[model samples]
Target: MAACAYCGTTILFGGIKDDDLRFCNDECFENGYALVIARSVSDNVVKREANKIYNGACPKCQGIGPVDVHVSHRVYSVLLYSSWSSIPNICCRSCGLKSQASNALFSLFCGWWGFPYGLIMTPIQIVRNIFGMARPPEEFAPSEKLENLVRIDLATQYIEEKSMPPPVNDV
Candidate 1:
């Protein structure tokens, strides 16, 4: 059995092959190609596409120039419970800053209730947010980080949309 190149699913029968890469289905082929294309494109093309996406409507506030930013926090309960999670905010810098502030505050208050891990992770999360806020994204251009994020996002969306089953109409 051959493993699929993109998703690593087992291939029990004949599968797709492009050169040495094999895929389980057409959807996988398309998804894999999407990622390959994103990675193989020149930096100039990538930057242009990234800037176009950044100029589009922001997913959160429907504004413009939204850059991808990740904000996470930690929460601890009593003695034995602790959790670390991120609040996903892919929006403008202002919105991301607000999200970072609130999540950091939440971590500061709630993340110190557990055991040793709570004490350790709380400060780390807070410091991370502080440093992240210190470096705001470019106002008129997308950074290299933002361009890579856009590429991944585009490939992910392509995979998601292609992998969904077609709707069946019941007459």
Candidate 2:
């Protein structure tokens, strides 16, 4: 009933010889170990610059800044209500690539367990994030300095994506 740790193939206690570790063969062990290394690298690279990516000014362009849109679904969690689950990560209004990627990772991996409301809301929110990042590139102005620093050529239109919508003062 035991499965190989690397390939998930059935293995007997006598077949693999790693004591407590369950590897069917040497090849599978090597491959599974390689995957572990790759995942570690991805985690390190993404997490190392997390502060700047989530807090600092836009790395791609000069004008656009991050925002805290009320539409973010992360505001709710199963254990806590209202502001308990609200982790305010930076969101881009002009070009939302990095922010969307980060938020999508969080929603899909970390908060997908948000049931009831999240069951319906989580998918819709991810779609919205995708659309936010899919806006036309021409709508923004590209920055060469950012390209040199981050190696990503992102562009933007405005400093702030959300204006108070002309303040429905008359209404």
Candidate 3:
């Protein structure tokens, strides 16, 4: 059993191959190729610049930072329909805490009305929110996810550039 080089899914059937790399599908091939090119363009300089930008003032409160990313879950249910989502924020500690508190309350109030999933997910979401609130934000460093977000943003731009055709030398 071989695994796809791009998404790591086990290949149960014939898949596309590029030299030594195998992909599960065309979408994975395209995405993986773009990632390779993006990695080539995203050198240490790009990472450092991204780090500096990420450590700037928090987007929500404009407070002095090295902000961290906070994630909170919310669940809503009515009868047979239940939906849940995770809300993520990059902000200072105070802002993150505030958001978490509000989201926790929202989940507590509106998350237990559905048939089965609401009953199951409500407590889970509340517990997750509680755990998230317990983790204190870093004062002098960006969260790991924050750094990854910055890197991804830069990588996307680089991928776009690599995919574009070269300018024609029109004299």
Query: Cα miss at 124, model 2 (Å)?
Result: 0.9
Preferred candidate (lDDT higher): 1 or 2: 1
Query: Which regions in candidate 1 have their CA more than 4 angstroms from the true location?
Result: 1-38, 41-45, 64-78, 86-88, 161-171
lDDT of 1 by residue, 45-92 (tens): 556767776777777777765665545454545666767775655678
Candidate 2 residue runs with Cα over 4 Å from true position: 1-76, 80-95, 137-171
Q: lDDT for model 3, on a 0 to 1 scale?
A: 0.75
All models, RMSD in angstroms: 8.6, 18.6, 6.1
Q: Model 2 over residues 47-155: C-alpha lDDT tens digits?
A: 3234344345654455445322222334234542222132222334554566565676566655545556556656766676666556523223322222222211110
Would you list the rank order by TM-score, best first? 3, 1, 2
TM-score of 2: 0.32
| Best-first order by lDDT | 3, 1, 2
Candidate 3, superposed: residue stretches over 4 Å from native: 1-43, 161-171
Position 139, candidate 1: lDDT: 71
Give TM-scores for every candidate, taking all chains together and pairing residue i with residue i.
Answer: 0.61, 0.32, 0.68
Determine which window of 10 residues in candidate 3 has minimal summed lDDT.
Answer: 162-171
Q: State in Å the error of residue 88, model 1.
A: 5.2
Per-prediction backbone clash count: 0, 1, 0
